[model samples]
Target: MLMSGSVSLYTDKASLYDVDYLSKDYAVEATFLQQLICNAIQYSPAEKPHLLDVACGTGNHLQFLQEMFVCTGIDLNSSMLAIAKQKIPQAIFQQADMTNFDLAEKFDVIICLFSSLYYLLDTALITRTLQMFVRHLTSNGMIIIEPWLTPDKYEEGKCAVQANQTANVSLTRLSVSRRQRDVALIDMYYTVYDGKNVTSFQDTHAFLLLPHTVLQGIFDSLGYATEVIMKAPFQERGLIVAKAK
Candidate 1:
């Protein structure tokens, strides 16, 4: 029951950040992801690779990647997938769990960004997902994963705040009380203000926090040529790039 008691403090809709919120911090995060993709493509031997974005939230990265590559997006959340579909009508989007998910086709590039891989809190599940990724990737294909900070690197009970204003509404969110159980859970509280009214919401979300070394080892065990890049643009975070052997 890790992260069993978590809650999301917003409306039934996905975070406004998914649609309208674009702060400097968010921009920076997007830039970092783009750079990672570019680097992977540059290093990959495959030309015109087919790309898959797992846990593809609102399809932000998919939309960005489609310009240069044939991209497909998958997510478990129907609402998020709906949004993604609207954003990238030309791209293929599907509903699939990150773990225990299978597609008949193989991909040349697979990416799990923004700590989406963290949803599989158990190490065994994470390893299983990695194996699935390997099976679905073509020879010489590469897998890129970005996971949240490990528990040892996180500040217990830490808090962070973000705010964004749009033409129609403004949003303020507070993330507090980081919890480390079998899974990492964060308590998020959000306040949404429309022109005439204000509303509040809360939801708890959980993510797995695996050690960097463990991820590298799993990639190796799966016959991947692995590399680890730590703290690229954010402290306490890292990326793992694994190419099929």
Candidate 2:
């Protein structure tokens, strides 16, 4: 199963985490998130959208969202929020948990990107978060979600992948032991060899891997019109878009 710890990755040993290396991953994730947002806006009934980016680490997507909509981000990490505030000065960033967060206003489009929804580690928690998303959505709003690979598609195991540089750092990372059937867990051991020094750090994340049908059923029960698209363009990830019924 995917094991996770509460230890902050951005502690004093931040060099071990390699912000430059992770920034590349964040870029790709932002591209996908933008695409999803664009599609949702095109299909949505709203002219100008209001977006909520749940677990918006460092506000990368939130910055992009601000270009087209009034965007707000919510994340559990204050340091990340501080960085995000620097990046998107006009947008708002709040510290909140996705599974049980409450906001007074609803949004026209709500996005939980980069598999952050999986961090909840429980199917019930995932469901609760979805319900909350629905509750916080305008009547015609859409909820766009991207989840990690299910056990049926990619089994739990170890794999090493190299990242293309988008910043000063280039690195290779190993993903070890992602074996939660109901929830996908991955431990990324990233090794960064800066010109002067070498450092390594691990980021363990857990994601709920509910089947597409299960998610559809949940949305249907909640009076939503849902669509599940596998292998979306611009990336090899799956997407679920749900609109109010």
Candidate 3:
């Protein structure tokens, strides 16, 4: 659930989320996801596989995935979920936390993409989240996660910037990354200019940077047959594909 008593970090600019990721190849990624599901699990065309997307921000992936599977998307941010609902009106969108959610239905494939798993911030939380996923999975279901930057790949004091524009709005986002022990911290500043007004906001995001060995160990401990694709298509963060052993 969205944390109460305080405004969520994403509340102000949820509408701009899609504009920020305009260059992402969601269609290609969705194709890759479809292939991964087909190859990883056994299913028939007559019965389309059901898929649940955890932390499905703005439904960008689901927009393309709905064509391939029966899709349901969940996100903790209401603002993000609203945008997703607007974009993919035909599909189901719900407000739910990744660590704990009960939809009362099972799925053939459950995917946590865009490095969302890192938000759990610790191995115990990550493990509990995966356990929840397993409970909601079918006998032959698969769990796919796109992990965050590993320890070896993380670069401290790195600064990145992006600028985007629409007919009525122009925006710039600046990000500076740092490391704190096993966690990676990214502080982001956004400056947006509308035709008549300008505004600025700042947000900090933290992720528990898990190494391949640690992540693989978690899967192994849970009795899953897992594969880690080092050269994943989109983020280069590598992808984890796992099935019940």
Best by lDDT: 3
Q: Least accurate stretch of 10 residues (summed lDDT) in model 3?
A: 1-10
Best by TM-score: 3
**TM-score of each prediction:** 0.85, 0.80, 0.93
Off by over 4 Å in 1: 1-11, 19-21, 24-47, 234-236
lDDT of 1 by residue, 56-81 (tens): 88887777677667889988887788
Q: Model 3 residue 76 lDDT?
A: 90
Residue 211 in model 1: shift from native, Å? Answer: 0.8
Off by over 4 Å in 2: 1-47, 163-171, 193-196, 231-235
lDDT of each: 0.75, 0.71, 0.86
Clashing residue pairs in candidate 3 are none
Give me the displacement of residue 80 in model 3, in angstroms: 0.5
Preferred candidate (TM-score higher): 1 or 2: 1
Q: State residue 134's C-alpha deviation in candidate 3, in Å.
A: 0.4
Per-model root-mean-square deviation over C-alphas:
4.4, 4.6, 3.8
Residue 127 in model 2: lDDT: 82
